[model samples]
Target: MTVIKGCRLICPNNTHDPILIPDREPVYVGRSEATRCIDPRCSRKQLEVIADWESGEVTVRQLGLNSSAIDGIELEKDRKCKLPKGGTIYLLVGMYPQRVEFTYKESPKSPSSPKTENSEKKNKEKKEALKRPASDHTSSNPKVKKPRISSVQGSKSHEIENGSADKAVEEDEEDIKQLEEKLKILKKNAAEKKFAFSSDSEGLLADNEQKKMTSSGKGKRGGGETSGSSLSKTLSDGSSLKKTSAGSCKSPATKSSSAGSDSLNRSAKESEGPPATETKWQPFEKLYVCTRKGVRARDKIAGFDIDGTIITTQSGKTFPTHSGDWRILYPEIPGRLKKLHADGYKIVFFTNQLGVSKGKTTIEDLKTKFGSVLDKLGVPAQILISTGGGMYRKPAQGMWDFLCQKANDGIKVNIDDSLYVGDAAGRPEKWATKKKKDFSCSDRLFAMNIGVKFYTPEEFFMFQKTAPFSLPEFDPRATVSARIVDPPSASLTSKSQEVVVLVGFPACGKSFFSKTHMIPKGYVHVNRDTLGSWKKCVDVCAKALREGQSVVIDNTNPDKESRQRYTNCAKTAKVPCRCFFFTATITQARHNERYREMIDKSHQPINDMIMNTFKSKLKVPELSEGFTEILRINFVPKFKDSKNERLYKQYLLEK
Candidate 1:
């Protein structure tokens, strides 16, 4: 196998002798003699070049404010590109071009192979050849030639160096004029093609051009393959489109020939529809956002929920039957959206598709469905999909935060002018014609979280009167009670050993109250979660009371049957058993549960099904159930900082 022994940077103008590229170390190319360029437009540290001898490739990273081109493709600041052998790097777009040259040598099959006398002589000659200047023209240039040190005096050498520097500067000025002309020609061609620059996505490659480059790159050549053979999205401003909350949608029609060819073929085989409906959606963590082409950022944003407000299942089922089983919800939706766009409002769709996470549907299916919907709508918009229960899901502000921070192209949204329309406004059944109760209240709470005006599909498009609806019963902004005990005279801690059983809904502050008030007071804490069973909880409580210690049972001992085991354990230990019944309502408990999910991400999410099961099994604790005393414990929330207090006060639960 052949391997690279050395590499050099060759200036085409013969400004100086070929500069050797140090192996495995970065060399800067800028306004310095070390790089053989004195152009003032180039910064002190413009391009960083590193050569890998094993791979026989040079890596060029842009570090300066000015952009550089590698193999005719623009390389932005902080972006790195691999330069194959014979690839050229143009500093400042066609000024001071440097071509890469590699020297190769054949490697022996094995280290044990014996070297012959003839082979040793050839190796010596090869090493000497590698040390000499790469090209004959470099050594022949009189203006850039080095003065003979032994014959010439110091002043004569200094004068020669000054003359060469002056000549290079003069040539640099001429190169600048040529660069301006090239830029003008590029702008003229772009205008002729009717191509407009977009901040999010730009520099689309033509299919024919990409095919031509790829076909030519497949053949073996003495110089090597160029990296520019692949189609790429290059930004004119040297800024990258981050895979953040805001993202640019991929159009299947203009898919890159280099990378998307295989996927496009697979998509064609998988479905028998318009290939243009299939877009390659990229995931940003848990959120999947696609901002289609022609979507422009504006101060006023008109947001809508996807499933019920914009589209409904054509199969007349609660869930979609297939990717194509959806249609526009109302006839006026298209006209309303077009009017908003004309009024300078950017349309955005936010939807929660838990089916994707549950494996009922894939991201590819959702992308195809979303693309088709946009095509039918005939208006460009951005779609945000939250596939699971997380910060990005509706009722949470992850999607809205992404829009404000990334999707708006740095434009600050005017919340007063912006509005959101959705069917899930917490309306009860019979609120509209043949209407059933909405599935969830996440959409309404989503708008509330972002402090935007909200409407339903009928209200926004058909001019229907605002109907009566209900919000969550538990208001997080309500002032919390300061009194910890309802009776006010009940003793928090007993002088003797006792077992305190807690009875309330899940997330009613049982664990928090136990850890805060009882644990510090020498009460042993027993939880079913840590023990993994109610039997273990009873056993631990029995042991604690037997050891003459008070125990706080931190489980949601809702029913009398579940609470009897602990009471029986206390009876065996001859200790009094008391019940601390939390005074929070079920709605208030659900609110607290969501608040914990937001603040402490590690806290396991308690979904609606689990909460509903607890509600059905609940049998409010009574003093008749072998409890010596029953105290009503009020949940008084305390915060250490104002930031936390503000976050807690926000409405977290939709229902």
Candidate 2:
């Protein structure tokens, strides 16, 4: 045998580089002789191998190139020939003469095996058996014979005696028919049971049909009868049933059809029972108002005054007073009263009417007129009238006490929270002044003295409608206390660092005071005129306060009601508040010479009449009632002297 080593071959078509195998096992086989052969038809390059008997040598037959254009080549060296390209290379191992001869032999054919032949025969037999007809159970016989038990019960025996075959066939057929009938009955019973259990009969029917198709032969007639009886019992016990004559009509279609009829009859028998009842409300039930203190107050009592308060008389004929007449509810008044009601404040018109005793108006007529006025005003509550009596009249507190006793049934008022609003004294012209008539009546004064918080119509209206006062909650006691503690002064800087509100007639030194005093003293000046230019000035002021800045409002805050807004704002910001009234006398105001200049320079025309009206209506800041501080500004000589710095310093220091 010859072996080849260290031989290489390369093919042009092979894209991947070949792996070089060194020290690989060589293979040898017997051959007749060693021959030199070339296959030109082969696409692979030809390589040659030569054998040497002496020294066990193998040589390359032709090309000795290290690399070749050939696709693959075989080589052998020493013991056996090696073709690295071939998966397994062959070598001739038998001994041969120096001149060896080669010969080729043909391969022999293989004989058939018995197992294969037997399997083929078995398959042919199976095909023939499948092509044959099925066996028949019936035979031609007049007599009805009994069925062979083995044949009917699926036995392995295939044949029966001719005498008994006919009987066996007949018996088998009868058994099949019975089984089918039982299956149908079982199916019907299952359907009825399913329908009884389901809320929807239509769905139950569909499910039953599907079940029957899937479980055709498994159902039994006896099982169906038992299931049907159970279903009937369920339906008869007040369970829902199809109520119709159709339900009661049993068809031979199913055994449960008759049971359904019996259930329907039972349901009809139970339908004769009595029905259920309903409820109603009791008489003498009433709605009452109760305080957080557990005090129950009167529901509808309202008191009215007779004099200039409720009735205004032109000459002799009596008519409703502007302040007294409920007919002409001020635009801002209704909304305010509604808000008070929403906050649980009972709205009762408390007034002292003495005209009945004076014989100016009869009690009956007055009541009728008052009732008409209240109706016109849409006052839905009841009215309590106290007339003629001296004790129950103005400045006496008798009338309020009487009404309270009657309405409250002796329940004392939490006086601190109650409010009294009226126009004038019990006698209107009694307190009239030379320059102006006193709108505050004696009754009003009495109410005020008795500690009832009094507010004029204008004051109440303004406070109710505007910001700050429009806040959802307020405590008058705290407000009055704060006002009494820190009275207003001309000096901007107070120990409390309170917010000062400048209020008076338009252009009546409000803005001037704010800019001249408040701003210079590190007080924040919040002018409504400036704020009015922007939509959300109050919000801006609130923000500044949140950041710890005190604010002063510059506005025509003529009424106590208007001033209340600023006071309330101060309260909300947890800051003290004061009111500064620019109380310049008419003489000084007209002669100052600056007034005309201001009027001329003003963008809005200042009507003198309107200005005077506003000034006259300006309510003095009620420091004892609802304000932290109140200051009166008077015009003194040298009020504007540029060199009187000492006097200015003195005023500032004293304030």
Candidate 3:
């Protein structure tokens, strides 16, 4: 790999100095105190070169350059890129071309393998042949030695040293016009070549035109490939699209000679479909819809979670305060999506932003930011944002169901090809950003609900296998059919009038079971949600017991203290109190909550805090808690007319 030795600052009276682009930290280039380079001629923190130390992949971004005059870096195009090895990338600070040169060097260790030894032999010969003539030219010139020595260090600095021998490229006023014309032609040809070879493979190949980049800057042959490449939405169709250098989306009409052409053709066949229905703010269950204008509904859908998956704050903080404080997380994200779009997958973004409903951020601001983000991404996509909590919130399939049934022009999604990727994968704390656990296991549950494959942002974007996700304890997938809990021949007496104290989490099937089975058996129902207090609930139960009628207390009697009041009331009435323990797991309870909230408008949404509270305070019920009879009530699946064994299906869509 080629290494950059120094940067030439083209300011009057300033001697040439070495500017090393170090790895990892953001190497600031300008007149700021914090910047690595302090050039009075350059603006404060005008440009930043972010480098990965190991691979030497450098991405240069403009921070506060006030002018459009800068040539290599473009604010409009977001021209930050991985700097090619063995080449010079010219960025204009004011009007002069700031040359960053990669110098060839001999490693201390000899090559081990025969192939490597042979390759190294060829490289050494090539370097010698190029340098052999240059040494004579510079020795005769004499003037090149001092300027080059001060500007670059080590044995490799000789080649870079020869270029500044005239001491005129950076400071000579007379050569400015000549340099400007030459630089213009070079930049134009380079831009054209970059546009033609769009992918990372082609980007490296674009260096072939380096001979024309600058008549002064010499080109060296470098052997390598992009060391790291990473993911979202699994693509099994064997379809792909070649991205352009400017990273613009080409109509499926543009054919590429690259290998991706086969994938692109395959994608066109997959994407062929009726036009998708385009609508913004199409209301559904207190949620708003916004589909990208030109997107079409296809059999295969590539769903993504927006914020942490697609974009992150440029500030490097976990959360962004302003709408504009965001950037595309990975460059591969755009390229991959463009390919997917070309291949025929309907790309959709499903995001939940509670801040919108809480007035921390406005709907208009979020929508505007989203529009700009998509515009910057330059891909057509359907968007579903659940601003308020309920069925539309992730972990529930309300948004997915809506997209499949209503938004997609009546095309049923193929779950085999469909996949979802999100950052809220219930991962351990600080999985992506420091000091941040995933907000919930909602994304995984969302995919599970819709019967599709799931992936975390790290898995999808960076192609990394993270530690096993800490899944929601209340996964409905594991909670199967509910078993009927028959009493041990004691509580089945038809004339017995007893108080049944139900026990479980908030969303447990206590109330549902009470209404469906217990009510039919002449048991009067009493609940805290309906009566407003447990005291009132106990009073209602007492009134019912006094009337010689059975009563079911349908509140989450989580611990001994909460259950004590109800048990004591029944004992005072001289009735044999029955403890009906609803044996639904947390997963089953959460599944029931999600289903009820989305399907039935009359049903209130179950808060996470309430569920957590019950989970935290829960104590195992014993016969010691003053009960004559204890019956284990296993969750029994109930559907109005559907017979699908998958209970989650009832809440999602009509089978």
Candidate 4:
């Protein structure tokens, strides 16, 4: 028998030809046509396999975003493991399994250790036993028990005594089919190699040479039967085979074959597919919440984001191609979640799915997708999904608040022990190898708003050191006050009638400042929102000034042209025009707007379009824009109640 040198990688489902592992060199395996791996989640260079013939081992390194496994042990990205002669390697969470097989030449036996008469006689008897029919051998063996299918209640009693015979039979048949497929493959390769020789005489000469070497070498190692014949006999007696505790099917003569490799063990169940989950998710206010069976609300909470954190698109896409297009982000996720559950921490997944509100995906589909993920994790958990923007969306503590206040069954959460893990931590591009910049900082901000510790997915799952990240410039937690006006002696009102135009972005405290400070001083308030248009506001301002009263224009007079309108009005009315330029940034205004939405539901939500439009048109109110005086008005937030003040201090922008 000829022994092939080095290791061979055989992906039974993906390719018929085995890939030869080059000695001391890395061979890349992935979705590339060369590797013949069609799994979409497999990257072009998903795995790096380095074979060492001298050591009889292979070094495998994970290089892709998804995870691979070696003999059931997880091999994560940038991590490597040494695999022995016959070990199975799984790509993308136990899919596309390829077994590495190391081949070696059998040492020849010495003629001085010739077989004795007794050993020769035993060998002849073993050959005769192999030629006997399997049925006759089974009937002759006293230890083998025949299945009893009786009439009346005897059949039911027999089933209760020995378990389901039909299931056992089905498993045996399946195992036999797999074994036959391997045998056929081996035969096909052997026949191809046999014909490749120059001539029949050369092939015959090689066979005679092998026989002489075997006769002159070490004694027969096993039952002296070829693997092909041994496998055929095993399949013929498949009905008598029993599953061992290790989940392998074996017969008494199974040890005769030297071909007991990892490929046979590949039939071990890797995944049973996603478990069927019931739709138990219920709507709580604006959040879609689901508590898996056996989950309990605990003091310590382990919160995670659904997308990019727990699971990712199996298609290697940013967005999923379908509802079922997803896989566990890392192989360690399930084990870690289980550990957290054992530590009395309630597992929770917080996700913002604005597309649900926009009709991109249905709520039922999201529920199914989430259910599949939870099922794969095999742990009891709770999921909170925010379908639309508002309090429930991340960067707002609405979901956290609801979990503590409404859900949790009245149990108080210990913020000190609770921490959130997500991918969107405001990390810049190249924060890690091949890591892209996060789309938003909502996860980090959500943890900040809930006053709990936060961690990115890499830090939590991979146990990596904290990476550098930036937060939004506007810190709502800061309570120290700054100067209300740029000039220390700037007065709120003048003794003579004057036109005061508030120049700032919307929600920058322009309306509040005019109503609180100017309106009570006999100055007529003018607003575009109230009067409908800028023309109407101008008319109202001119009318108030014509009556010898001071007018306060509370509108976002952003550009020089808009501020010129009010300044021209003051000039025509023979009064001084002053610009109260509000020095508030766009981020601060956005934070204030969201705070208002939370406190007052009637306050219309200001979208990014409105804020961006104001920013684009802004030219910075200047003394050159025909103003008698230009005073900078700083935004100083005030709260009526202590609860409102607490809420105001929480982060509101996603950034």
User: TM-scores for all candidates?
Assistant: 0.58, 0.23, 0.52, 0.57
lDDT of 1 by residue, 461-573 (tens): 98999987888888777898899997998898898999999988788888889888999999999998899998888888888887889999998887899999988998899
Q: Between candidates 1 and 2, name the one with more favorable lDDT.
A: 1
Report how far residue 557 has shifted in candidate 1, in Å. Answer: 1.8
Structure candidate 3, residue pairs in collision: 144-165, 231-460, 231-461, 232-460, 267-343, 271-344, 430-436, 474-587, 482-635
Kindly give the stretch of ten consecutive residues in candidate 1 with the minimal lDDT sum: 267-276
Q: Of 3 and 4, which scores higher on TM-score?
A: 4
Residue-level error in angstroms, candidate 4, position 547:
1.1
lDDT of 4: 0.75
Please name the candidate that would achieve the greatest TM-score relative to the true structure: 1
Q: Go through the candidates in order and give each one's C-alpha lDDT.
A: 0.74, 0.42, 0.63, 0.75
lDDT per residue for candidate 4 within 1-655, as digits (tens), equals 3444768888857564688888888998888666667867778889999888777778899899876766434565786777644667777544577878777885575454345765676577555544454444343422223456566655667876456544554554455456667878887545433311113421222344334334544212111322333223333432333434323234443455324322222221111112215435666434678878777756678999989999899999999999999999999999999998887788889999877654477666987888888889999888988876667889888898888877676555767778999988999888989988889888998998887789988899999999989999999898646678879699989989999989898899998998889999999999988999999999998899889999999999889888888899998988999989998899999988988987885476688899999999998888887788889899998889998988788888887
Q: Per-residue lDDT tens digits of candidate 2, residues 626-647?
A: 5665776543332345433222
Pairs that collide, model 4: 108-217, 108-218, 109-216, 109-217, 109-218
Sort the predicted structures by lDDT, highest score first: 4, 1, 3, 2
Candidate 2 structure, TM-score to reference: 0.23
Q: Which ten residues in a row have the lowest lDDT in candidate 2?
A: 279-288
